[model samples]
Target chain A: MSTTVTQDMSFLYLISSASVLVQLVMLILVLISFFSWWFIFRKLFVIRNEKRKTDDFEDIFWRGVDLNALHQRITSARYDSGSLERIFAAGFGEFNKHPAGSDLDAVMESTRRAMRATYQREMDYLESHLSFLATVGSVSPYIGLLGTVWGIMNSFRSLSSVTQATIAHVAPGIAEALIATAMGLFAAIPAVVAYNRYASSTDQLATRFESFMEELSNVLQRRAAG
Target chain B: MSVSALRNSSYSEPRILLAGALAVLVHLVFIAVLIFGLNWKDQQPEGMMVEIWTELPTPIQESVKTQSPPKQIKPAPEPVKPKPEPERPKPEPVKPEPAKPAPQQAAVTPPVKKPDITIQQKPDPIKEIKPDLERQKKQEQERLKELEKQKELEKKKELEKQKELEKQKELARQKELEKQKELQKQKELAAQQQREQAAKAQREAEAQRAAQQAAARNQITNEISKYKALIQAKIRSRIVMPPDLPGNPIAEFSITLLPGGDILEVRLSRSSGHAVFDNAVERAIHLSKPLPLPPDPALFNEFRNLNITVHYRE
Candidate 1:
């Protein structure tokens, strides 16, 4: 009998045999964990791609590539271009829309505005679904805890129906309940770690974009002044 | 609106699908690995948490074992010597009797006393012959000759009697010596048989005692395990382990028990470092009063002080 009980203590058995509420809670945690991981991976790809694109654009731009040629190349491949390139194209297009003798400060301001708007959209694209990761990181543990508490309560309540209460009587219930907490920890740890890593990387990319925009604005203002 | 349009165009649907597929694959792999790992773990042999005291160091057992050999050797020659000693005294009396009888015969027959007896006989014959002096003188000569002849015959008869007595005594001495020799041989054989019998009896008794001791030790060990299991099971049942105890921490306790199975003392020899677990174990030990002890009083020593470990899992 004990052998059977010990054998049935596997995670699959425990999860499968859990009470309805606990099962529901575990389901919620699993869904949260799955989606959180999905977002984590997607964000990982997005941030890495964005960082590489920014590095490419910065290298080419700094090596004194002709603004017109660079702008033309970026605009031709607009759909395939990175966020930094789009921001540069937006700023350069806004600069060329003014006459050669236009007010330098007004042209520079409008150029900065276009770059800022594009920068905002690119940052939004990079950080999408990150809130879901943050929510999973913060909330899944509590949901798992709730499942555990409900499981323990159910087990103890069932104890009232029995005359003798051995650890055997209550141990399986408690063991099954503990799996919820374990699942919560399992889901929360990775989500929290991924969220932190992706958030910092996105922030780094935003800084790079802002610096590039500032440098471009200065260069365009100098050309207008010249 | 333009920024939203541009962001929508920048998004690649294939990449999202790829990431999602990878995520599902990763989760499925994790579940499969978990299932496989747990199944593998199920095959693992559970560790033994309870250690029972089967062999006790007993000085008396060693003494009993060492004392059997000398006892077998000591009595072999002891009874043989005393029995032969009493028999030797019996032969000594028989030897002295033959020697004493020869000296008594020599002292009884005196040659001076024999001369007096001859003088008396001569006087008696002279009184009767007073009237006939001449005839008496001839008769006296004849009587003297007869007396001399009778004395010589009597001396010869006494010598023959002495020779016969000496021969009889020598024969008796020879017979007695032979009897004593036969008796001694019989006694020596009896002693040897007795010694062999005694040795066999001693060996059997020693073997029986050894067998009994071994049986007793086995019984003690069996009873110890029986009661140890009982006490541990009872305590384990009574234990209300604190939830969330990390790992399988073992709490060791040395329990002192009375003869009647009542707990005298319980000291935590090794703490599991979880106070709640330690306290729960301690409480359980206290709650399980009057543990099941072996009925035999001799086996009580084995159950007197027990060292028990309560593993968190077990």
Candidate 2:
């Protein structure tokens, strides 16, 4: 049969009005998605550089180079952006501030405080803007469902005017409404993936910072006692 | 004490005593000022009465006292003078009468004339007579002026009464005109309501006729469906079954029929699964052209566009 399909614009109007909240939520999701990608890429670059610098510094430090000479090289170059390098510099600077043969306990206390402060600063920077990604991952599906509910309500309301209902009468409206749900999933999947990945990377970096602090503290303690 | 001990001892005791005494003196002064000031403030009047007392001068106070005492003494002196004036007049009149009786009595009354001279020196009787006569003439003039004012007021009241009567007549005329306008407005409103009633009745009759037409149209639709079913069955028999049908395929096809029962459009809602079998169903619909027509024009119009579902494959 030649199926006569008619759409009431009033249905669209109802759907659009109900979808305002969904649209607002989707807008926020999209913004969060964009910012998450941005942070992921930026942190990827920063962490990669930090890893390289840390590896180089560890190599140089264990090679029996004089620490004062290494300090001069680090000061002049200023190229190292690693957390370990900053921790090392803070601890050593505090160690050099005291007179020679001062109390070993006092020297170690100052160096530990300096390294803890630097570690806190680096962790804060790495963890910034991560919460928004988490919120997007958790809430996006519900936001998309809100849009789908609004669209289905409009479809059912228009069915009242129809004398004999058929698939042709309902399909297009349902299809258009489902697009929002699909978009929500689209925005949410990447956010969730990025959050899990970045969180693990940040945890690894934090563990490294803590272990480095302990090792550097032991080194400064020995230097003070000697 | 040694020299250092002597110096320290000399400085310390006097300094401590002087500081202690100064502190005590300061506390005593503070306590005295607080107690006495509070007592004096409580004795003072509610607001500032000092302003009112400062406004009066000594000369005004003195004038009030002097004026009150003089007024009290002047009334007493005037009564004494009246007594002397009456004695003097009695002696003068009594001398004439006694000359006929006793000349010696008339000579004794001459001493009463000296008393009259004492009264005249006081000048109180002459001042009292002048004031009394002046007061009586002033009261008579005041009474005459009051009578003239009463006559003028009566004339003004007559003019006011005439104006009030004119205003009352004008107000009555205005009230008559307002009543006439209100009556006219009521008449117009009643006419408008009658016109509206007539129009509303006409609209009701028109709507009833349209509803009757719609009912007739529905009856015609029922009759056309009855006849179209017979024609559809007749056309179904002429359709040949295709031999290459797949495995007992069963489906239905619907077609829109025109006014003369000619198939307009055809589609299969349920597919027979075999492409050749489905194509045969479509060709059958095309081959059966203008199979039958309805007898009545209204019934024919009702079947102008029709939907039919046909079951294929037995």
What DockQ does predicted model 2 obtain?
0.02
Candidate 1 lDDT, tens digit per residue, A173-219? 88789878877877899899999998899888888899889889989
For candidate 1, give the lDDT of residue B94: 70
Model 2 misplacement above 4 A:
A1-26, B1-314
- How displaced is residue B167 in candidate 1, in Å? 54
User: Among all windows of ten consecutive residues in candidate 1 chain B, which has the lowest summed lDDT?
Assistant: B48-57
Identify the leading candidate in terms of TM-score: 1
DockQ score of the complex predicted as candidate 1: 0.21
Best by lDDT: 1
What shift in Å separates residue A178 of candidate 1 from its native position after superposition? 1.5
Task: Give lDDT for model 1.
Answer: 0.80
